[model samples]
Target: MAPACEPLPVQLGAPSTADPHARYARLREAGPVHPARLPDGTVCWLVTRYEEARKALAHPCLSTDPAHASPKYEHPPWEHGPPQALLAEAAGRHVLHSDPPAHDRLRNLVNRAFGTPRSAFWRRDVERIVDGALARLAGRDEPELLSGFALPVALAVISEVLGVPHALRARLEESAEALVTVGGRPATPNAARAAAGEVIRLMTGLFREKRAAPADDLLSDLASAADEEGGPLDEGDLIATACLLLFTGYETVAYALCNSVINLLVRPDQLAAARASPALLASAIDELLRFEGPGDSAALRYTTASVRLGDVDIPRGECVLVSIQSANRDRCRFAEPERLDISREPGDHLAFGHGIHHCVGAPLARLEIEVALHRLLTRFPALRLAVDATELEWHHLMPLRSARSLPVRL
Candidate 1:
C-alpha cells in the first residue's frame, strides 16, 4: 500500500510582501496542496505540484463564476460594482469564464477564426507587425523594450486580428492597463472606477462596430456566432469575450516577450546559440515561459462542492489559487527548476495553464513572441538593459506578473 502524503502546512493571511518565493517553496516541499490567504483576507487553497495543479484545474467541481464565489475575488474593481453593462452582456457567452457546453459552443465558434488555415494566413501579417515594431526601435542607442517593442507588437497583432480601429488602439491599450491595474496594485476607489469605465466604454464601442460591419475579425466571427445552433451569445457576452481576449492576448504575451529578451541579453552565450540556430528560439521561449511567464498566480477556481486534495479539505464555493510560477519551478517536475536553461526542453509548463480554461490564444501568442524575439535579437546584437535590472519594478498585486518597464540599449 502507498503511504499517505502528509498535509502541507499553509500560511493563511500572509502579508503582500514584494516576493513570496520563500514561503511558496516551503509549501511546495511539504505537500502538493495547502491553505493560503488572499489580499482581501479571504482564505483559499493554493495548489503547487504539477500533477495536482493539473487535476485541480480540470476538476469539474471547480467553478469559474465570480458571483458564486467571494466578491473579493473579482479581477477588476468594476466587476464588484454595478457590473459594467457591456462586460456583463458578454461574460457567460464566452469561454474564458464559462463552464462546459456553453464554453464548448463559444470556443468552437471562435476556434474557427484561429484554425490552422487562418493562423497560416496571418503569418505574413504577424511578421509585418513584428518587423514594423522592431524597425521603430532600430538604430537607437537606448530603447524601452516594453513600450517601444513588446507592447506595441502584441497590441498591433491582437488589434489587427480583432479589426480594432487603429486610432482607438491606444485607448484600448490604456483601458487594458487600467483593467489589469484595478485588480493589481492598490489604487484610490475613484481611480479604479474610472479605469473600469474606460474599459467598459472601449469594449462597448468595439462591440457596436462589430455588430454593424461584421468584418473578417474575431469580433465579427463572435458577433455572427449568435445565430448558431445553441442560441447565439448576446451583446454582453460578445463584449465580455472580446475584452477578455484583448486583455489576455496583449498583457501576458507582451510581458513574456520582455522577460525573454532580458533573459537572452543577460546570457550572451544563449543569445549567440539562438542566433546560430533558429530552432533554439522555440526552446528558448519555452524556457522563458517557465522562468518568468506572466500570471504569477493562477486564475481563481471556486470549489463547487467539498473535496479533499491530499490532506486538505476544500469547502464548497471556496476559492483555489493555483501558483503556476511555483508549479513551473517544482523540483520533482523539472530538474534544476530554478535555473534558466534555454537549450533545455521544459516538458510542459502551466504558463498557458492546463485543462479547459487553458489560454485559447496560445498559438497566436507563441507566433508573436517567436517572431518578436528573433527579430529583436537578429536586428540588435548589442542589446542590453538601459537601466539597472534590479531598479525595474514589477506590477504588484496584479494576477498577471510583469515588469512595469524594460529599458534597453542596443
Candidate 2:
C-alpha cells in the first residue's frame, strides 16, 4: 500500500445515485477505508465497511464542525457555490455542526419540541395532508409522484408543525428546492446565495411574528427561548436551526418516501405483503431504509486527531466520509444483505445514523413514510410507473438519493 500521506489515484467523484449500492459493495469488499479525492480536489478517507463506518460515526475525534477541518481543506465536498465561510455565516450554527455541551443544548431543545411523542401527535395532520395530496393526484391523468404527492405532503406536514401559514408554504418549498438542488443540477453560485437570502428573510420575519404572537408550534417555542437571557437559542442559532429543519425535515422525508415507493413498486411480493398487513408494513420500513436509505452517507466528518480505522491510518485535520448506505448493506453485518427481505429484523440499521447525532427527526420521518405509503397504496390500487423504470433519472446529490421526478399512472 502507498504511504498514508499519498492519496490513491482513484477518484470518488460522486456515486451514481441511481445505482450507488453496486459501487459501495465493491468498495466495502476492497477494504474498510480508502483514500480518495473528491470532485472539488480534496483528498479524504472514505469509510465503506459496516463496523468501521459505525465506529467512525461516533468516534470522538471525527467532528462534524467545519472548524476541525484542515487548513488545506478549501472546498466542501457537498457544495460548490459560495465559500464555506459565507454558507456557514448564513446557516451553520445548528445542532448538526456542534460538539458536546452546545450540541446537547441545541438537540435538547429540538427533542423537547419534536420528539417521538410530539411526532406521534402529528399523525392526524400527516394523514390529513397526505390524503389531500392523494386527492389531487387522483384528479391528474398522470401525476408526478415526487412533486405532486410526496413532496407536497412532506412540506405541508412540516410547515404545519413549524406554524408556517398556508400563504408562505409554496414560497418555502421553492427556496428549499433551490438550496438542495445545487449539487444535483448545474446551478450558478448566486442560486444558493439567493435562496439562502430568501430563507433568511422569511424566517426572520416569521421569528418576529412568532414572538409577538406565540403559538403552539416548534418555531414559537424556539422563538420564545431566543427572547430570554441565557436561553438555548439566539438569532443565529434560531435561523440556522430553521435552515436545518427546513432542509432536512421535508426534503429527506420526501426523498426517502419516493425511494421506498420505487423499491416496493418494483417488488410485487413486497408490495403485496406490505399492503396485506399493517404490522408487516411497519417492519418493512426499516428494511427499505437499510436497502436504500435516502442518504448514502452521514454529514461530512473531520478528524481532530490521527486515528486508525480498520487497517488504515488517517492523519489529524483530514476529512472522513462515512457511507451509511454501504454500512447498512455490509454482508458481514447483515446476512444476504443485497436482498430486500421485509421480514428481516429491523434494528441496528444506520439509516437514521447512530450515536448522539442520530437524526432527531427519525420518528417523524418514519411516521410520515408510514402514513403516506399506506394512504398512497390504498388510494391507487393500480398505481404504476408512467415510463419504464430504466428511463427514470436520479439526482446526483451525494448523501441524498432522489429521483428527479416520479411519473406515475394512477
Candidate 3:
C-alpha cells in the first residue's frame, strides 16, 4: 500500500500554462492527492504522486463513463455541451469514454486497425516524412518549428494512415484547431459544432467508400471489422471515432515533438549526447516525456464510491484529475525529479498512461518523435533556437500542452 500524508489546502487558481512542477511539488510533499480547480471552476481531486495516480487511473471503481456521474462532475468548458455527449454522438461510436464490455469490444475493433502489420508499414513511411520535413527546415535561417515542420509531419502521417482525402486535409487541420480551442474560456460552440459536423460528414463518406471498395488503410480495416461483427458502427460512432483519432493521434505527437525539440535546444549538452549516440535518443525521448510532456492532465475519471487517497476522503461522483505532468516528476519515483537526464534507464512512466486505458497510439507516437528528432539532428547539426526561450508562447487550455510556435535557427 502507498504511504499516506497530511492533506493540504487546495490551490484555487494557479496559472495552467506556467511550469506546474513547483505547485505539484508542494502538493506531493503534502500528500498523494488534494483538491484543485479546473479551468472552468470545477473542483477536483488532483492525484500527484506516481503510485497513487496509477492506482486511481486503473481503479475499477473509478469510472471513465461520464453517464455514471452526476452533471456537477462534468468536465469544464461546460457551455460547449457535455463532452461525453459530443464524444458519444459526434466523434466515434464508442471509445475511451465507454465502460467495460462495450469498451472492450470497441477497443478490439480499433486495435485490429493498428496491429503489427500496420505499424511495420507506418514505420518506413514515418521515416520518409520526417526526413522530408527536416530537409525543408535545413535551408531556412529561422524556421517556426511547429508550423513549418511538426504539425505538417504529424498531420500528413495521420492523414495517410486514416486514408482521408488529400483535398480535405486543410479542412481537417482547421477543425483540429477549432476543436482544441473549445477547451478555453472563449468557447466557440457554433464553430466547434460546425467543425464536428464537417468531420462527421467527411468520415461518413470515407466509411461508405471503404464499404464499397475496401483498401489496406485503417479505415478499410475498421469497415471490414464492423462488417465481420455483423455491421459497421453507427454513423455517429464512426464519425466520432474518426474525428477523435484525427485530433488525438496528431495533437499529442505534434506537441510532444515540439516540446522535445525545445528541451533539446535549451540544453546543449543533452542535445550533444543524443547527437553523438543515436541509441540514447530513445531514452532521451522518455526523459523529455517525463520532463515536459504534452499532456498536463489525464482524461477525466469520476469516482464510483467513496475512497481515501492519502488523507482525503473523496466521495462518490467526485471528479479526479490525474496530473500526468506531476506524476512523471515525482521525487519518490525519480531521483532529482526536476532535472533532465537523457541517459537514465526507463522504469515505469505515465507518458503513455497505465493499465487498460493506456494510449493505443504509443507505438506510433514513439516512432514519429524518434525518427523526427534523429533526422533533424543529423540534417542540421547546428540547430538552435531563434529567440530567447522565455519569449516563446505556450498553450494553456485544452488537456494538451504545447508551444504556440517554436522558432529555431538551423
Quick one: best lDDT, which candidate? 2
Instruction: Give the range of the ten consecutive residues with the poorest summed lDDT in model 1.
Output: 76-85
Per-residue error (Å), model 3, residue 393: 2.8
* Residue 263 lDDT, candidate 1, scale 0-100: 72
Q: Please list all clashing residue pairs in model 2, or write none if there are none.
A: none
Look at candidate 3 and give me any clashing residue pairs.
Answer: 90-240, 91-239, 91-240, 91-241, 92-237, 92-240, 92-241, 93-237
List residue ranges in candidate 1 displaced over 4 A.
1-22, 70-94, 182-189
Worst 10 residues of 2 by lDDT: 79-88
* Candidate 3 minimal-lDDT segment of 10 residues: 76-85
- Taking every candidate in turn, the Cα RMSD to the unseen true structure, in Å, is 4.1, 2.9, 3.3
| C-alpha positional error of residue 270 in candidate 2 after TM-score superposition, expressed in Å | 0.5
lDDT by residue (1-410, candidate 2, tens digit) is: 32332336446546353577787777777788988776677777888888999999899999988778888875445532232223356855777778887788778778888853556669899989898888877767798888777777878888888889889977988876776642256346678778777877888899789989998888887788775656546677766776677667777888899989998888999999988888889778999999988886788889999989999889999999888888999999999999998999996999898888998888888889998898888989888888888887886556677787888888
Clashes of each: 5, 0, 8
Q: What is the C-alpha lDDT of each candidate?
A: 0.71, 0.79, 0.74
Q: Estimate each model's TM-score.
A: 0.87, 0.92, 0.90
Error of 3 at 139 (Å): 2.6
